[model samples]
Each structure stands twice: as structure tokens, then as C-alpha cells.
Target: MCKAWDRNMYKLRFIISFQVQLIINFKLIAICSHQIFL
Candidate 1:
């Protein structure tokens, strides 16, 4: 049971980190586009 809980926690953490990374990448792309426009 403990192992299952731990695995779930790891999955949740991984998802959050993945989302954060995606957000950062999106922001970077937006900034690059804005710079090009200016």
C-alpha cells in the first residue's frame, strides 16, 4: 500500500513538472514572436 501511494505521488509530481515546463516553453515562444514583430 505504501509503495502504491508513493508511486502515485511520483506521477503527480511528474505531471506538474511537465506542465510547468510546457508553460515555460510556450512563454519563450511567445516572447520570441513578439520580438520578431517589433
Candidate 2:
């Protein structure tokens, strides 16, 4: 039971971190596009 719980926690953490990275990437892309247009 303990091992399963640890695995789930790790998976959840990974998913959250991955999502954060994606958001940062999108923000960077938006900034670059805005600069190019200006």
C-alpha cells in the first residue's frame, strides 16, 4: 500500500511539473511573437 501511494504521488508531481513547463513555453512564444510584430 505504501509503495503504491508513493508511485501515485510521484506521477502527480511529474504531471504538474510538465504542465508548468508547457505554460512557460507558451508564454515565451507569445513574447517572441509580440516582439517580432512590433
Specify the highest-TM-score model's number. Answer: 1
For model 1, the local distance difference test gives 1.00
lDDT of 1 by residue, 9-32 (tens): 999999999999999999999999
TM-score of each: 0.95, 0.94
Q: Write the per-residue lDDT of candidate 2 for residues 1-38, one digit (tens) a residue.
A: 99999999999999999999999999999999999999
Q: Can you give the lDDT of residue 28 in candidate 1?
A: 100
Scored by lDDT, model 2 comes in at: 1.00
The residue ranges of model 1 lying beyond 4 angstroms of the native Cα positions read none
10 residues in a row with least lDDT, candidate 2: 1-10
Q: Mind sharing the TM-score for model 1? A: 0.95
What lDDT does each candidate get? Answer: 1.00, 1.00
* C-alpha positional error of residue 8 in candidate 1 after TM-score superposition, expressed in Å: 0.3
Distance (Å) between predicted and true CA of 22, model 1? 0.2
